[model samples]
Target: MKVAASMNRIDVNEVSKPEPDPVLVVERVSMKFNLGEQSVTAVDDVSFSVRPGEVFTVIGPSGCGKSTLFNIIGGLLGHYEGEVRIDGSKIAGSHESIGMVFQEESTFPWRNVIDNVAFPLELKGMGKSERLDRARHFIDMVGLSGFERHMPAQLSGGMRQRVAIARTLAYEPRILLMDEPFAALDEQTKLLLGEKVMEIQQRLKQTTLLITHNLSEAVQLSDRILIMTYRPGRVKRILDIKLDRPRTADVVGSEAFGRYVAEIWADLREEATRGMSDAESARR
Candidate 1:
């Protein structure tokens, strides 16, 4: 995890309880990509750390390289500067300790809930009875216990996403990465799913890294939030949220939550405006 040049608010140490040693570390991470004839920087000098059993999120305007940075951390993309380490060892290209959920709908249309969740175990050549048994636990964990036989098409959008999450959890990766995994969902659904995530995290002590543009979503889910600059993304600011655990509707509706959202929105408004202006200027 990369640190911002400075934090915008919250003396993190004062607001939050002490945490265990970091589980993930991003050091001086940077990257750029070819855009037509020009090479555009996507991420620059980003550094941060995520502690064990914490939900750490990156929230920024679109085109802030959140996706690019996520890809690099998940080992999906290469040729990046710096390194990403899990448990103190550098990782590259899809380490077993890392499990990722993409922004797109990732469920296999042909497979039912059980099979989908069991797929990773199956890939590892676990016996059918054993893999399905493991899958059932995660299915229950994600609140899809009885939907084991239902096909992806039979489920609603939220259910499908739940299945996807269960599938990832079934594999039991040391760290979970979610890239705008609920961007397609409605607000109510997002909030519900978020509670589900928090519940699961509390039960499992899962260490998660999330990339989202939604301010409220970040506020609801994150223990800490990292902001990136408009483009050629750099760590702009990091803010800590001290909301009580097992966050509920009451927590979301509280004045504290509203303040967190407003603070992030204020920073995001400026960055997003810059990104839009940059896009317009480039069009000229």
Candidate 2:
């Protein structure tokens, strides 16, 4: 008799547990794009590492190449010169365990919330029952319990972003790469989703790298924040958030958190402003 094919189910608990080894270790990474005869450097020699179960954030000016850095780490920007190591191995191309959420809405208008969340699982070749179960679990984790059947068009901007996160999480990735995922939402929605994301990160203890230009968002969500300089972006500072766990967006208003934010802004604001000017000139 032929035996039934048993697929391996991803256990979130196993993913939550900290790896004895570092999850991501980026060293001296740089990227350059060719526009005609001119060479454009989007990212300079930037280096950082994320340990297992860390909420690591990269923040900078709008054109400071934060997203470029994320692509390098995700193996999406391979044309760059320098090294990006995930789990101690140098990444050469698209990596399987690195799940990404872009700034744009990633949901399919045709697919319902559950289906959108299950897309990654389907791509992984998981069976219908198993993928649906995992998708539902992540949808609930992102606070979209009753709206599992709702279409992307039916959900709010924040809800759509939540679905995107659920889709990434359902893959049970070793690392999550989020590029300004909440930048398009309303302020109130951004605040709420930011807090919810932080809570989920803490509960799951996933090693995540979030790239954003929002200072408050970086402070509220990350254990460590990496600041980048303009044009050819390079690491400016790495500020460790000393505050205790389970931090909310409101924590940004606290005196201690305020001090950290102010200090980091002070260090980068001038360079960030200059970066914008450089970008404008390049456009012309």
Name the best candidate (by lDDT): 1
User: Any residue pairs clashing in model 2, and if so which?
Assistant: none
The estimated TM-scores of all candidates read 0.92, 0.90
Per-residue lDDT tens digits for candidate 1, residues 211-268, read 9999888989999998788887987777988888888645789877887888788789
Once model 2 is optimally superposed onto the true structure by TM-score, how far is the C-alpha of residue 257 displaced, in angstroms? Answer: 1.5
lDDT of 2: 0.83
Superposition error at 162 for model 1 (Å): 0.6
Whole-model Cα lDDT per candidate?
A: 0.87, 0.83
Summarize candidate 2's per-residue lDDT along 187-207 as a digit string, tens digits. Answer: 889888999988888888888
Model 1 lDDT on a 0 to 1 scale? 0.87
C-alpha lDDT (0 to 100) for residue 156 of candidate 1: 92
